[model samples]
Target chain A: MFTSIKRIVRSGFVGFWRNAFVSFSSIFVMTITLLVVGTVMLGNQLLGTTLEQIQNKVDINVYMVTTASQESVLRLKTSLEALPDVREVTYTSREDALAVFRDRHKNDELTIQALEELEENPLGASLAIRAKDTTHYESINAFLKEQQILEDPSAPVIDRVNFNDNKEAIDKLTAIIDTVERVTYIAMLVLVVASILITFNTIRLAIYTTREEISVMRLVGASNTFIRGPFMLQGVMYGLVSGVLTLLILYPVALWLGPATESFFLLNIFNYFVAEFGRLFAVIVGSGVVLGMISSMLAISRYLRV
Target chain B: MIYFDKVSKIYNGGQSTALEDITFQIAPNEFVSIVGHSGAGKTTLLKMLIAEDRPSGGDVFFESLNIHSIPKSRLPQYRRKIGTVFQDFKLLPHKTAYENIAFAMEANGRTDTEIAENVPQALELVDLADKIWNFPSELSGGEKQRVAIARAIVNQPDIIIADEPTGNLDPIATYEVVQILKKINDLGTTVIMTTHNKGVIDALERRVITMDEGRIIRDDAAGKYVL
Candidate 1:
């Protein structure tokens, strides 16, 4: 058993090296497939990061009337914070709002003179509410509406709710993210399946050329495993080499795209690739080996039947 | 010993008959030559012996075991008992002559030391020891066929089946191949050969089973080249 294994491995290496052109072509095709798969993975990561950044910037701002007390505003903030969907509610006091307005018009002397001539600060205290997920904003907005109704209807303490103004932008962003996620997943699935089939047929063609050699092996009394072992090893080698090649190829690609992606989406793909090198290596190389092996096995089985 | 008992092979549901009710026995260590024209069932009969093609109506026995009925898993072990050579010299084009012979030994689970020792000796026996490293494409027809023979006998099988081994060789190479086969037979290994060459048949003067349309027309001890 040990001897047979050794011979099979030796023969596999010999066959792989001797049939250099065939082996090289197989590896080349497999590397392309692996690159597609790896690129899809990186694209998904970039998309996810971009979407999360956009989501973090989306929130509902609640404005308080100038006459509303700090205690009442704190109570509203505490209630909004108690909601399960609300991640955080940041309170800005009327004094801080007026100070921010002053700082903004600090460059404009006309605006400063108008602000100083005013008897009181016009800026209202506000609370900015953020939800755990973009989708949870609707429920949080509903909760704030309930809070508004609880106030005095004739003379309301709440000045305004800005959720409606931001609603169109949030919904559009959410729809875009959902559509993109679905399309990317479907495209990735289709690409992966297509790559597998192409690799399979390539291996099949390689085996077809060796059909006569396979028959000769059988006639010489080689067992099915003995006959198949070398080809399996060849398949594995193809996968191993192609996987490493894909990874190496991705390094340069990630470097080129890193600055662009980082500037646009605030995610450096090259840094992600390096940080996730272990996982990327496992996925790409593992896929290459598995695809190569399965293709080889299926292709050679047709010729193995005596 | 081998026996073919009333074996008949019909292809494509009786569209053509390759073998019809053939019965024959080959005893141990006997050099037998099968002589016939093309499509005369000589190749089919040899295939039946190797269990490459199964008989439709009868059984072929290697000792007491039915060659055709041997389970698929055990078929390799069964085939290893007999060495097979072909007219095309079916050596892998990518493998060297030494590797070609070593492949057979490797298939039989021979030790590395044994293969390292026996492959050279087999090549030397075929008198192509100098061409051990040559690939099939690099070698001539006779040289490639000799490497095939070396592959056949390297593992020391009980029988060697050479199917038209000299069909492509020149008179000189054919003579050389026949001499080596004769020498292998002299070494007490049963050599069954199928040939259309009358020169080779007459020169052998061994047991000849002449077939016509899948039936043995003549079986003679020390036979001559008579159709």
Candidate 2:
């Protein structure tokens, strides 16, 4: 058994080197496939991070009436926090709101002068509410409306509700992100199918090149396992080599593009690749090996019947 | 012993019959030559012996074991008992003469030590010792056939089937290939050869089976080229 395994390995290596051009072509094509797969994975990750950042910037601010007590605003904050979809609720005192306004306009002379001329702080105390997810924002908004903290004069008597101002922009952004997520999924599916077909054809051509040799081997009293063992090993070698080659190509490109993309996306892609090295290795190499083996198996099955 | 018991083969579901009711027995260590023109079912008959194709009717037997009846898993074991050589020489183009013979041994689960020890002897038996490292393209037609013969006999099979091994060779090369076949036969391996050459059939002068149109026309002991 050991000898048979040894011969299989030796013949597989011999077969690979003997058909150098075909092997190289297979590895090259597989490398490109892995690169595309890796890039899409990175794109998905980037999209997730970008969407999270955008969602984090979305929130509703409820302004209190000038006559409303601070205790009532605190009670409103507690009530907002009790909602299932509401992620967090914070109350900013009028003085604190005024301080923030002053700080924000400190660098602009005209704005600072305008703020100083007002003498009294015009900003109202407010409750800022954040939702757990973009989809939950609507539920939280409904809850706020039902409470009428800002709309109904008798209910909490808040001066204004600022949620509607950014509602349109947030809804558009959510729709775009949802569409992009769906498109990315479809694109991934298409890429997987395309890569499988390409790899299949590539390995088929490689096996076709060895069709004569395979028949000759069959005629020589070689058991099916003995004959197929080498070709399967060759397929595995193609996968293994291409997997490493993809990483070789990917790492340097990721390194070079990391800082460049970081400036645009505010996320370092190289760090992500490195952080997920083990999983990426498994995915790239596993796909290559599986694809190569399947292709070769299909190719060789027709000729082995003799 | 090899026996074809009323074996028949009709290709493509009776679109054509390649062999019909062919019955013959080759004893141990016998040298048999099958003679026929092209498409005489000579190759098909040989294919049946190696279980390459099943006979449509009847059975082929190797030592009382029906060749076609053997399970597919055990077919390799059955085939390893017989070695085959082709007119094309069927030598792997990339393999050297030595590696070609070693490949056969390797297929049969021969160890590295056995392959190393036997491959050189097999090459020497075929008179290709000096060109053991030469690839098929680098060798002459005769030399390539010799390497094929070496590869066939390397594992020391019970029978050697030469299907027009000298078909691609010139007269001198043909003589050389026939002489090597005779040598292998002399060494006690049964040889079943098919050919169209009158000189080869006459020179063989052994048991000759002549075929025409998928039927055996004559079977003669010590026969010549009588068409």
Candidate 3:
């Protein structure tokens, strides 16, 4: 069996060289298909990173009653900060709120006069809460709603609801980005599937050209695997070439596109993570091996009845 | 020994049966010539011998083993014991006459030393030893036919099936191929051949099994193509 295996491998290689064009073309198809698959994976990562940047802008704000005690509001701010979902919280006292209002109305004398004419400070002390992730904002909202210290019975009504209130617009923006990411993922999946089908068809054609050889081999008493073994190796060679070449073809393109894309989409983000060349290359080579092996196996399986 | 036990074969999707109610037996070392007109189930008989086609009814037995009923996994081993030659030569176009012969030995699990020794001997038997390295395309029709014969005999099986072994040859080439088959048969290998070349068939005057319309029309000692 081992000796037969050697001959089959040798014969397959010899035949491949005899028909150089078809053999090389098989490799070419294998490479191109693997490239398309690997490229989709990288594209998915890019989309994921972009969506994360979009989600980072969301935050939860806690408003305090206008007459709430400064000590109670400070205590509430400290408690909110201790929650796992709360990344950070900034406490704004009533005096600081008034000062901000006065600063804004410095050039507007009528507004400043109206503000002075008011019997009390109208601005409320607020605690701005930053959640660990965008989705945690809702949980933080519920948690804040059950807290009693944020609302003062002696002051104007203050519910734990978000006060800055761009929640609807933020939610809509996140949804749009989420939809875009989903569409991109679905499109990438379709492309990978299409690549496999294309690879299968191409390998099928390669098998077709050698059908006569296969029949003659069978008649000459060659075992089914002995005849099929070489063709499977042919597929492996194609896949290996394709996979390596795809990496070669795409690596430079990725480098060229990465900075250009980063500049366009993530001007203030993406600096936190460094590029991982080895992991990316391993992925490309692995993709080529799998693609080549599977396509060849599929083609040879269809040729089995002979 | 080969026996056809009332075998009949009908293709999967066809109007009529290709072969019907055929029964015959050929003993070991017998050189039997099967003569029939085209579409007369001559090739069909050869197909059943190598287990290429199953009989739709009855059995095809080589000794005690029903040739048609061998398991799929056991087919390669069963075929290794038989040698087959085709009218078209079926030689790998890129292979030398020697490699073509060696390929057969390789298929039957012969060691390299055995193939190296026997391959030359088989080519010499076909009288093509000097042209052993020449590719099939470079050889004449006679030489290619000889290479096909050499490939068929290199493994030295119990039986050599020649389906129209000289179907593509001229009168001279046909005679040469017949001489080779006779020499192999004389060496005690069973020869089963099918042909329409009456001159060679009559010249050899071997045991003839005649068929018409998928049935054995005649079987005679030293028979001729009476059609």
Best by DockQ: 1
lDDT of 3 by residue, B77-182 (tens): 8887788888998998867888878877877667899999999899899999899899998998888999998888777788999999898888888889999999
Docking quality tier of model 2: medium
Model with the higher DockQ, candidate 1 or 3: 1
Clashing pairs in 1: none
DockQ of 1: 0.61
TM per candidate comes to 0.82, 0.84, 0.85
Q: Which stretches of candidate 3 lie over 4 Å from their true place?
A: A74-125, A130-133, A142-152, A155-160, A163-166, A264-275, B12-14
Tens digit of per-residue lDDT, candidate 1, span A210-232: 78778878888989999899899
Instruction: Return whichever of 1 and 2 wins on TM-score.
Output: 2
TM-score-best of 2 and 3: 3
Give the candidate order by descending DockQ.
1, 2, 3
| Docking quality band of candidate 1, CAPRI definitions | medium
> For all the models shown, what interface RMSD does each have?
1.2, 1.1, 1.7
Interface RMSD of 3: 1.7
Ranking by lDDT: 1, 2, 3
User: Per-residue lDDT tens digits of candidate 2, residues B11-117?
Assistant: 88789989989998899999999998899999999989988888889988888798888999998898888889999998888789888888788888989999999
Candidates 1 and 2 compared: the better one by lDDT is 1
